[model samples]
Target: MSFTGSLVLSGIGGLVYKYGGQQSERETEVPVGFQSLTIGFFQARIRVFRTRLETLSRTFWRQLVETSGYKYPIRGVSEMFRSGAYFFPWARAFAFYLVLYLTIAFIYFCTILPVYLALLAFLGPIGFAIAYLHFLLHSNMLTMMVMRFTQLHNSLFDLALVHNGKEIFVKTAIQSPTLPKRYYVPLNTYYFWLNYLPWRIFIFGFGFTVLIVLLLISFIPIIGPFIFNALISPFIARIYFSRFLRLKKLDNKQRNDEFYFNFGTYVSFGFVAGQLEILPFVSGLIYSSNSVGGGLFAIKALDSEHAAAPSGATAAATAAVSGSQARQDTTVA
Candidate 1:
């Protein structure tokens, strides 16, 4: 059977098992007639199962939004840019450059591919295969570079926040004493690219298949096309986050917080990318830079420990004075 068919059958079996089991239990406990008991139990189970499925669906969406990638809203991006935040403008500019480069590359590919195919007949299939492989390698390298850029942005912000004495209250904040500089390089350029070979191929194949399916289905009327295409946004976000999470620089807590906090932003960015593929570069740069600025703010807050300490010190002095007064009373008595 097809994968979708199998999934449907599994779902059906699960429902049957749940209802049948519940009916059996009810029949034994409730002193009602077996027929009535069975019917009531089945109805109750269906209601419960439906409620559970709905809840699960909602939770999945929430997770997709919350734990995806660079979670900053566009308004946050604008605010950071207006404030002359050091990271924001650079990130935005970088994003634009990256998008421009990608556009040019696509144009080149479209023009060159037909000529290459025609020439390959005179040349050999092996030469064409090698060229195609090289292209794939470069594409993977680009993806890795993007991931590194994200990591660097996050790291810079994290460091800035810590330095500033901010009470950075992300759920995960275990500090990394050292950062691996090599991990930030593009995949093809990395020394250990082979290590990720299996997973990379699997991910690429899955993504390619999904994209084809979405493109095919996206021509349908009303909700059909939009809904299928919408799936691409979350998938992109998921892949980006998965890459970000694999970075060695972040501690577990920081990674978790980053994943959860940035999911919505990632999803939004993905949706934007699907409609306008060039947007990812610009969005990535802006979001990463904003995060860096926020991190700096956090560091500044952390650094201002003097403000926090004075309140505690003052309270301690007050307690000491009260203690002295009590001692004097005791001595006098």
Candidate 2:
């Protein structure tokens, strides 16, 4: 993983050194493949799913090496907090929440009631601003953390894991039972309401569906959570890849898997990850690592069903062969 991460970084760094100079205007185009209309939407989506499965199996060798999914999320988050890059997002978010709260309070009490009612007119601007601030926190750290871990995930295969931040379009982990000692954040203790007080009330909140999904399946039986977990694992992986990881979205599956899939893993990874999201300054830091966790989950899920990757084939070269094989196998019964 280290070797592959280094190689991916080195390759990107070399590109940056060559063509990555800072410029005033910034724009990059989304790849045009997935957005195009297809003849059999279901069939096209199935083929794409097979391709993605093959890609991860062929590419995510490093992830395959791990016996536990909890390791990377733990370490990545620890590094984030230990270094203190995780706090900025929450601080910004809570600050906005506070200011907005106070402004409304003042309008309700301190100012004329009619004017306060009129001030309700500002909800559009205020709402947009609030959502924007929350969105702001998860993304910057997210893009870097995701791409790096992606390289790490695919390290053994060494496919060209290069990601241009341009592919980071609008969004999007599961771990086992581990009970920790009662704990709390150091400085930002007050911000915990982002998780507890507001259930989808906050403009920046990201875990509503996880709770819904978990509840939806809770009556089914013991395996409900795990059942939903496996069912939604690919969606979770793609979210990690595209949203927090800021990579391009993997498959065009809008036509299928809607009920079980989400760009945000809300209950599985998002719920677990959000435990730290209310921790003010470190929220984004901890949240950004969720992608790796999600990737590892997806890698484990897929590899369990597929054969081993070929030895000594550079993944970049063999991916075509692998994809072709997957397509040919489409007709297999």
Candidate 3:
């Protein structure tokens, strides 16, 4: 039997086992008559499932918009360029990326060129394999840049939050112990490139794992690569999403807030983001920005949720700033 055929049969059996087993205790009649099941019970199950589906949809979009790396980056980049301020950070981020790319491409090319020559010398014509390998390696090197620009933009958003139309936020950010001080050079260039290391590992690892799994099931031909990628999309989205959020927290010098995403919200939203990521480059841009959008969205939600109750991160930041001020006062006194 084909893999897909087996999956269909198993899915049916599993569904029956799950729902039937759930109500089995209530219906003690062995080989319980299909006639014994009432419409009301079926309706209740349908309602429960519907509610879950609704929740999943909402949560997925929420996370994608609030914290995703997909859409927010593109939009954020656009906004940054349009504003005409902070031109240096945007330029600096891309420039650093360019430098890193050229450097890596050169090094990898030099190292791998010998390997390529050996393959040609020993094996003779091997189709496009060598060329493809070079391309693949170059792409990998560039992906080392991963979320640099987006993270830089998001970090700026944090400052934007504190400043909120005031000029002193820049001064405060520079002087404040809690808030990250630098804006352009290190902030846009080194910090994000360094920060994205784990994210790069995750994307590469996940992609490689999926490839392995696909190979194992290659004979079955049931689960195509696209279907498989879609299935694992949420997990991938969550990996990047969580990384970006944590980086944001670190940038703000705020403690981690584990409860920010609540129960299934984070994972479900990741799923949605992953699904939307089907369209090649454009989807990626949208999804990245949406991730940041989702994050900003969630922050806004938190602001409302805790309108009466203050934010823990904000409170701690305030305390740190206050302490710094106190120390300065003591020095003067």
Candidate 4:
């Protein structure tokens, strides 16, 4: 895996530096053919994955271990049961949905268990592969449900962020109710669907194609799933924190730039979040937890950036203080 990752990074870097550098020049100089275009597309994708893999630094791994984000899953589960007027109603709704979801899943699994076992029997030694594929199928099939769950709990996520911020003392994260609100629509609203359906269709169509490719990749041995996870990390990250990103008022272009600029950090964060989300029975709960976790990450990230980057006012204030100190020292001398 290391060798493959390194080789991919090295090769893609060179290819991008060569063919990717001057797109207009290349388009003019060499007639763009289907073959070249296809290669270029794949090259771009490779570069993206390579950049993500390269971003998994040792410090990131350490932070992953230390960060409270990983605990938010259990925290989310606990929050669901916590006693509060605000939480009780939502908790009951979640409980009802969970019961219904699990009941249906139980029946479905009972119906499919014999067939699954037969396949396992036939596959024998490769039963693990079958099981893995089944898990992936189940995980990917829940994408729509995941999105719906996210929509349902958007307000909860916002509140969780506020709570998390208070715990960590990040003032910006503790935003006010009077914050200039963006126009909002409920997920189930007709207007929302009307505006979103076209985009949803495109996303689903593209996602189905990607799913087929991932299924093929899963046929590979151990490293296949790792590679698959790595490739999808960025998308997973964005989806998990889509609401938080919007809350931060990052327009599409700004979000894209942020993702590219901090590609490594996002990938590392997403990879961990994705792993937790791959579990079968608890994935829905993890979805809720992921909102909180993603929020915590965003808070810490913004705080770190804020600390590292002095604001215009902060810089001016610091400069003024320094100049005053210099004058006082000169007078004393």
- Top-TM-score candidate index: 4
As a TM-score, model 1 comes out at: 0.35
**lDDT, candidate 4, at 281:** 45
Candidate 1 per-residue lDDT, tens place, 127-189, comes to: 577455433332222232233333334444443344344434332333433432211213432
RMSD of 1: 20.0
> Considering TM-score, where higher is better, how would the candidates rank from best to worst?
4, 3, 1, 2
Better of 1 and 3 by TM-score: 3
Clashes of each: 22, 7, 25, 0
Q: Candidate 2 on 265-328: residue-level lDDT in tens?
A: 3234443443433333344334444533544444444455356655555665686785455333
Backbone clashes counted, model 4: 0
Better of 1 and 3 by lDDT: 1
Q: Could you estimate the TM-score for every candidate?
A: 0.35, 0.30, 0.38, 0.50
> What lDDT score goes with residue 29 in model 3?
16
In model 2, what lDDT does residue 182 have?
Answer: 16
Candidate 3 per-residue lDDT over residues 252-306, each given as its tens digit = 1121123232324454454455444433233434433444444443455445556
**C-alpha-based local distance difference test score of model 2:** 0.35
lDDT of candidate 3 vs native? 0.40
Residue lDDT tens for model 4, 34-153: 553345434544565555456554345554455544454455556544525236435644564465445444544465434555667767858756654654434332332333323544
Please give the RMSD of candidate 4 to the true structure: 15.4
